[model samples]
Every structure is written in C-alpha cells, then in structure tokens.
Target: MPRVVVDVMPKPEILDPQGKAVLGALPRLGFSGVADVRQGKRFELEIEGELTEQVLGEVRQMAETLLSNPVIEDFTVSVETPVAPVPGAGA
Candidate 1:
C-alpha cells in the first residue's frame, strides 16, 4: 500500500503560542542550541493499492479543503513508497 502524508503548519506571519511555549521550556529542560520552534501537524493516510496521479490530486484537494486552513496555514502532500517487511527476526 502507498501512504499519503499531509503536513500542515501555521503561516510564518502567524503567532504560534504552542511553539513558543515549547521553545521556552527547552532551555529549562537543559536542551540548548535551538533558536525557535514552529508547531505543525502530520497526517498519514494508508491507501489501498498503487498510487495514481488522480489519487494524488484528490489528496491535494482533501488537504486544501479539510486538512489545512488556507488563510493562516499552509500544507504539503507527499506519497510514501511502501516499505517491504524485512525477513522475520523473531523466532
């Protein structure tokens, strides 16, 4: 199966309170070297069978209509190639 990945994030001009809060906590948690953070969302859709261009177009429409808000956010869609299962390691 091919999977579709949708990533949605706040527009750069928007204020991200959650990201700010996380950024503020990182230093207190002894984590350093991080200047900023922007919160985002990722959605994985497991689609049956091979992925077609029409399916990709539909996914883009889904993202534009439901997954993200165009006014304050932007989104990207990608198709993930199916990963074959490795030979059994468990007895």
Candidate 2:
C-alpha cells in the first residue's frame, strides 16, 4: 500500500493563538532555547493500490478542498516512505 501525507499550517501573516499558548507554556515546562512555535496539522492517507499521478492529483485536491482553509491556511501534499522495522530491535 502507498500513503500520502498532508501538512496544513496557518499563513505566516495570520496569528496562531494555539501556537502562542504552546510557546508560553514551553518555558514554564523547563524547556528553553525555543523562540517560537507554530502549530499545524498532519494527515496520513492510505491508498488501496499503487500510487499514480491521478491518485496524487486527487490527494492534492482533497488537501485543497477539505483538509485546509485556503483563505488562512496553506497545505502541502507528499508521498510517505514506509520505514522498515529494524532487525531484532523488538527483541
């Protein structure tokens, strides 16, 4: 099976309150050296068969229409490579 990933983020000019809240909490949580934080969304979609240009195009359309708000958010689509399990790592 093939997989696709979509990443959505607020436009740079837009204010992200959630991101600000996280940034404010980081220092109190004993984490330092982080100057900023921008919250976003990631979606993984599993394909039923071999990945093709049509499927990729459909995924892009999906991202644009349902996954993100084009007015204030930007989204990127990409193919995800599966990570093979390491030999004996679970042992």
Candidate 3:
C-alpha cells in the first residue's frame, strides 16, 4: 500500500483570520513571546493496489482540482510505501 500525505496551507501574502484569532488568544492566555502563527491542513490516505505512473498523475491532478485551492492556498504531496525487511540469517 502507498500512503499519501497532503499538506495544504494559505499563501504567505494572504491574511489568515483563523490563525490571527488563535494568536491573539494565545497572548491573552498567559502565553507570551509568540510571534507569528500559521495554520494548515493535513490529510493522510492509504492507497491500495499498484501505484502506477498514471495513478500518480491522477492523484496530482485530483489534489490540484478538489483537495486544495490554487488561488489563496498552496499544497504539497508526499508518497510513501512500505519497504520489505532485509533477509538475513539470525544467530
């Protein structure tokens, strides 16, 4: 199985209201010395079957189209697969 990790975040130029709200609260809660705060979303998916080149292409397109907005937000994708253990004679 292949694991897909998607991290979506707002563009740097764009102002994040939610993050600002959280930051304001942090200072009031006796947590000082906080400079900046940025929030993002993470998604983990397990993809079964053969992860062919075509499938990877499709996944990229899907993430661009539906998973994240290209205007105000940017996203990154990471693909991971399990590695088989090395065969060896144990003493």
Candidate 4:
C-alpha cells in the first residue's frame, strides 16, 4: 500500500491564534531563537492500488476540496515515504 500526504496551512495574511499561543509560551518555557511560528495540518491517506497520475490528481482534488480550505489556506500534496523495519526488531 502507498500513502499520500496533504499539508494545509493558513495564508500569510491570516491570523493563527493557536500558533501565536504556542509562540508566546515557548519563550516562557525556556525556548529561544525561534523567531516565528505558523500552525498547519497534515493528513495521511493510506491507500490500496498502484500509484498513478490519476490517484495523485484525485488526492490533490481531495486536498483542495475537503482536506483544506482554499479560502484562507493553501495546501500541498505528496506521497509519503515508507520507513524500513528495524534490523532486529522482530527478533
């Protein structure tokens, strides 16, 4: 099986209250050198069948229509890379 990823983020012009809250808390929590922060969403779709252009297009459409709000946000779609199993994990 292959997995698809969709990342959605607020537009630069939009305000992100969650990201702001985290940014404000970071400094008080002993974190520094971070200038800014923007919050986003990631969606992973594990799908069956071969990875083809049509599948990619459908995923893109899903991102544009349902996964992300095109009005106040922008989205990026990609195929997720699979991780290899640990050499001795099963042992």
Candidate 5:
C-alpha cells in the first residue's frame, strides 16, 4: 500500500498564539538556541495502490477543499516513502 502526507500551516503573516506561548515557555524551561516556532497540522492518508498522478490530483483537490483553508493556510502533499525492513529481525 501507498500513503500520502498532507502538511498544513498558517501563512507566515498570520499570528500564531499557540506557537508564541510555546516559544515564551521554552526559555523559562531552560531551553535555548530556538528562535521561534510555528504550529501546523499533518494528515496521513493510506492509499490502496501505487501513487498515480490522478491520485495526486485528487489529494490536492482534497487539500484545497477540505484539508486546508486557502485564505490563511497553505498545504503541501507528498507520497510517503516506504521504510526498509530491518535486517535479521525476522525470518
């Protein structure tokens, strides 16, 4: 089976309160070297077969219509890469 991943995030111009809160807490929590943070959403879709152009188109449509809001958010879609099986883990 194949899979697709959709990543949605607010536009850079938009203010991210949640991300700001986390950023403010980071220094107090003894964390440094991090300048900023932006929150985002990720969606993973399990596909039935090989990832085709048509499927990609449909996924893009889905992102445009339902997965993300075009006004304040931007989204990217990509096919998931398969992981190699571990060697000597099983028969």
Candidate 6:
C-alpha cells in the first residue's frame, strides 16, 4: 500500500487569524522563542495496491477541488510506500 500526505497552508496574502492567535498565545503557554506560527492542515491517505499516473492526477484534482481552497490556500502532495505486512502475522 501507498500513502499520500497532503499539506495545505493558507496563502501569505490571506488573513490568518487562527495562526495569529496561536502565535500570541504561545508565549503565555510557555513557548517562548517562537517568533511566529502558521496554521496548516495535513492529511494522510492510504492508497490501496499500485498507484498509477491516473491516480496521481485524481489526487491532485481532489486536492484542488475539495481538500484545499484555491483562493486562499495552497497545497502540496507527497507519496510514501507503506511497509509490507509480516507474513502470517494476522493468521
């Protein structure tokens, strides 16, 4: 199996109130030295069996259409292969 990792972040031009709030609260939360913070989303998807170019295309489309907002955010995708199951482990 293969896994796809999606990382989405709001564009720099957009207003990130959530990130700003977190940054402001970090010092009070004992997280000093943190100069800045940006909010983002990470999604892990387990893709069964082999992954074809078509699947990659679909993944990109899905990311653009549903996973991310094209107006205010940008997203990147990474693919990782899952370790094979041990023989007879679940038997």
Over 1-91, each residue of candidate 1 has an lDDT whose tens digit, in order, gives: 7899999999999999999999999999999999999999999998876799998999999999999999999999987777786798552
Select the stronger candidate by lDDT from 1 and 3: 1
Ranked candidates, highest TM-score first: 1, 2, 4, 5, 6, 3
lDDT of predicted model 1 = 0.92
Best by TM-score: 1
lDDT score for residue 63 of model 5:
95
* Model 2 Cα lDDT, one tens digit per residue, 1-91: 7789999999999999999999999999999999889999999999988889999999999999999999999999989865676987872
Error of 1 at 11 (Å): 0.9
**Residue-pair clash count for candidate 1:** 0
Candidate 6: residue 28 lDDT (0-100): 87
Q: Residues 1-91, candidate 6: write the lDDT tens digits.
A: 7989888999989988989999999888888888778898998888876788888888889899999999999999888766687987873
lDDT of 4 by residue, 1-91 (tens): 7889999999999999989999999989999999999999999999788888999999999999999999999999988766676887872
TM-score of 5: 0.87
CA deviation > 4 Å runs, candidate 4: 82-91
| Per-candidate TM-score against the hidden true structure | 0.91, 0.89, 0.78, 0.88, 0.87, 0.84
Q: Which residue pairs show backbone clashes in model 3?
A: none
Clashes of 6: 0
Worst 10 residues of 4 by lDDT: 82-91
What tens-digit string does per-residue lDDT give for candidate 5 at 1-91? Answer: 7889999998999998888999999999999999999998999999888788999999999999999999999999988776676888773
Whole-model alpha-carbon lDDT for candidate 5 = 0.91
Model 4 clashes, total count: 0
CA lDDT for candidate 4: 0.91
1 versus 3: better TM-score goes to: 1
Give candidate 2's error at residue 45 in angstroms: 0.1
